[model samples]
Target: MKKSIFGILTFILFSMNTFAQNTVAEEIKTLSKDKWQWMADKDVDKLGKLFDDQSMFVHMGGSWGKERELEIIKTGFIHYKKADIHEVFTPIIIENTVILLNRITLFAVVANTEVSNPFMVTEVYVKVGNEWKMGSLSFSKLMGPN
Candidate 1:
């Protein structure tokens, strides 16, 4: 009887832990989706808050830190006109960090020239205290159609 009771308790504990992780993952997904919109709109204020102080951004042109990225967006240097998300892969959570990949077709204006490209965007978010902050964002160009 004790063994059976112990087994049930263990299963219950495991299930609850899984549910909590799933909830956190869902929150991360929602935040990522909102981030895309914020980028499109060039909402620097919100982006500034989402991004960590030591955040890094990688692009086809080059890589930069949070301040430079914000400057680029604010000045219309690389206007993220739109992002058509093709797929959002399952996020991998490791303790307080989450890594997510998104396949997307990005339409943007760079140097006053409009262009579109397929890319795999990788985003890393780290939970700090009770909030999640973006630590890294990278764009890898894909050779294919949208």
Candidate 2:
């Protein structure tokens, strides 16, 4: 009876740990998609909420911080008519108090620039407390259909 009870407890603990890990992965994916959604829609307020005060964003030609990203959004440098994200995949890495989330996002650029560019991107996220924050992002421009 003692051995049986101990086995059950171990199983439960293992299950709980697995569930918790899955939950973190889901949250990371949601945050990844939300970040892109905010960018495509130029939803500055939503985007602002996602960034850490010290976060930095480096794009093709320039780099920006939380405020700078918001500023560009306000200036209409990026405009979005419709955004379609495909093949979104996020992988999670946990280290002590810090969780690292890396994802590949393939999207369509609906507006903004005249030149054709790749929409596929990689985003890095770090967990702080109970929330995950974006740390770095990089994108590649693909040749659009002629």
For candidate 2, give the lDDT.
Answer: 0.64
lDDT of 1 by residue, 35-145 (tens): 989988999999999999999999999999999999999999999999999999989999999999999999999989999999999999999889999999999999967
How far residue 92's Cα lies from its native spot in candidate 2, in Å, is 1.5
The RMSD of every model to the true structure, in order and in angstroms, is 0.9, 4.1
The per-model lDDT (C-alpha) reads 0.95, 0.64
What are the per-residue Cα lDDT tens digits for candidate 2 across 20-54? 87777777777776776777688888877777787
* TM-score of every model versus the real structure: 0.96, 0.70
For residue 39, model 2's alpha carbon misses the true position, in angstroms, by 1.7
Residue 103 in model 2: lDDT: 28
Clashing pairs in 2: 118-141, 118-142
